[model samples]
Target: MVLEDPSNPLVLRNYAQYLESKRDFSGAEEFYFRATQADPNDGEILSRYAKLVWELHGDQTRASGYFERAAKAAPEDSNVLAAYANFLWEIDANEEEEHSSNAQVDENAVLVDLPAKDFKEEKRPSSPPLHLAMGLGIGRMDLVGINQDYIISCPDDRTTLEEYYKRVVDENPCNPLFLRNYAHFLHQSKGDLHGAEEYYSRAILADPSDGQALSLYADIVWQRHHDKDRAVVYFERAAQATPETVFIPFGFSNVLASYAKFLWEVEDEEDAIEEAKNRMPVGQGTATAANA
Candidate 1:
């Protein structure tokens, strides 16, 4: 069918899904790419391609580009918005884990020190890496590792990462993924709570159903702004927006847990607390209460 009607994006996408189920990832990738080229506005195809890239190849940066495109192509698609939000959460979790691991390095561990004469200074490259060029060609300035490479290549330059993030947000202003990431970078790395809050608000404005952004924004409101009422509103919205599915069980569970905790501890709203508890999975309510 695909060969007979080579321009049929649905057929191409179906074939890609079939190939993916058969574990023919390379062939599936080809078909998926073809499907996207055939119908660039198909958010479903773009989301599927993004998931395949992330799951099969573990290429977060490339998957992010596809997901961003998917969200842009279909701003009103709930499934696509949920998937993109989940991807951003996964990226945040991985980055936090990496930071935690780095922080755990033994302070007392002895390091072998080489003589000064044993080391030679290496010349820095005149331009960004090849991956950066490819990313630029594809209008993906937010490829994670390429931007990190540019920053690492010039350790003395602290603004490289911020500049790239600014450019990405500028180019994709309404993209929740970019806005959320920029907000996170500002809050965590730059210590700019005001900027983070602004971007987080923009992200939520772009996609009010983005549970991750809603949850994180709630945290900022609670911790930084000390606006308990507003924070509760955001947390409740996050809980309502987050769907309980195998793909995003953690996100849903976390939102529910946080909401419950806030209701119980912060607002001391017993009725609301019980409501939130009932929404949680069995045993999660007990654990959340204990943690609270």
Candidate 2:
């Protein structure tokens, strides 16, 4: 097919996938890259290429750029969004591990003469005022938005956000949004998987219909603990709850896509995969099946 029409992105991508399945990573990378060049806007091709670069070549920078591009190219694609999110989570986990190793190295370093002031703890910035407004009759979603804004604005200073999140969740212990957000913060910022799992479980207990929380919890269970049975249960709950979660656009579709991918790739369960395909949104199931 490449000999007949080298510019055909679909053919190129298919060939790349075939090579990947055969463990010819180098050949797969070349064809995936060629496919992306042929069709720059194809999010699937871009995502595949990004995964290949990240996993095989260990080029985090290049992979991150490609993943961002893939998300931008297909914002509505659940698979693309999930893949990008997973990539980010993996990066965070890796960085946390590296930081831990570096801390150990620093602890063992030869003592050097230094000023007493150098040993002083740097004072962290004060928590943002958004949490202070909790008593002003602020809505739950409004608080969520405020927290998100603060986190985005102060990406490097998670200490403030952590304090703010802890306060908010402490006051609103039953609020699923607050609990889930706090759980996510613990997972990403504090590298506290166990803490995150506790909060995620609390979030689910607070609101059984919270699809996003369920899905996120499922991810943690699968990735962190490798508990396949528990993960499947949570994923199924997420998919079932997604339809009632009106705030999330295409929520059901996203859950279905994530569930299908989990079954197909992680578990490799044929019956579960078929069931997931049957539940997926119209054309998406066809595409997934074809790719499989």
Candidate 3:
């Protein structure tokens, strides 16, 4: 039914996802290829296809090509950039492993003397290879911008990751995911407490019922600003927004834990311990409720 409109990229992409979920690699690849052909400029779709290719083929070289294409397609899209960064990180890790394995093999091999080959002057190309000199026709996005998190973590590049976060935030001001992640990046990487707080405020304002955002905001305000009163307000809000039963450990319970810690450690309230016990008891009821 979805493929009825073969021209619709969204439908094609969704079909591709369905195929991928079903573990139909070839089917998924065909659908993804069609989707990309239908909308070559869609960064999200490209990224999805890139990830599928990587998972299906387990070849970082081919996957990197797709990732580079996706990043170029959406230079300002933070998700695509992050995906590209992850791809690069994996490739680097794989290369390091290969080098380590080679070194170990070399170390175990017994030394043997061999006659040195005579040096010969071979015919060389008159000019550099055309492909080597040629640039990808697509606009060149700054490597630092696409791999901001990697750069910040490694700290090898001279450029700061602040600009990339600022650009992504500016481009996607209303996106809660982007705003919260940018806030986190600023807080962790740059130690820009004030800037992080501002972005966090925007994220919370956009979605009051977001327990994670509320908890994160509370943590930041309490830790950095040292305003326990303001922090507790957000924490209480987070607890209220939390569901009674959550399957995910990092769900509502994590937020509650944060709140409990603040109460016990900072406020020194005995109710904190009581609240934890009351909220989550060690019994089949918790498991049953989670299953339900």
* Every candidate's CA RMSD: 16.1, 14.0, 19.0
Compared with the true structure, all predictions reach lDDT values of: 0.73, 0.73, 0.66
- Tens digits of per-residue lDDT for model 1, 177-263: 778877877887778899989999999999999897898899888879778889978987886687744244237646655554555
Off by over 4 Å in 1: 107-292
Q: Which stretches of candidate 3 lie over 4 Å from their true place?
A: 105-292
**C-alpha TM-scores of all predictions:** 0.40, 0.43, 0.38
- Sorted by lDDT (best first), the order is 1, 2, 3
Candidate 2: list runs displaced more than 4 Å: 105-292
Among residues 3 or more apart in sequence or in different chains, the pairs in candidate 3 whose N, CA or C atoms overlap within 3 Å are none
Best by TM-score: 2
Model 1 clash pairs? none
Q: Cα lDDT for residue 67, model 3? A: 72
The worst-scoring run of ten residues by lDDT in candidate 2 lies at 133-142
lDDT of 1 at 100: 97
Q: Write the per-residue lDDT of candidate 2 for residues 1-292, one digit (tens) a residue.
A: 8989899999999999999999999999999999999999999999999999999978989998998788668754657767765676666667768988887744335255544455332221244334343321122224333433243335464445567677778988888778887887788767889999999999999999888789889988987887888988998788667752232322554565666567655645556777887888989977876899
Spell out the clash pairs found in candidate 2. Answer: none
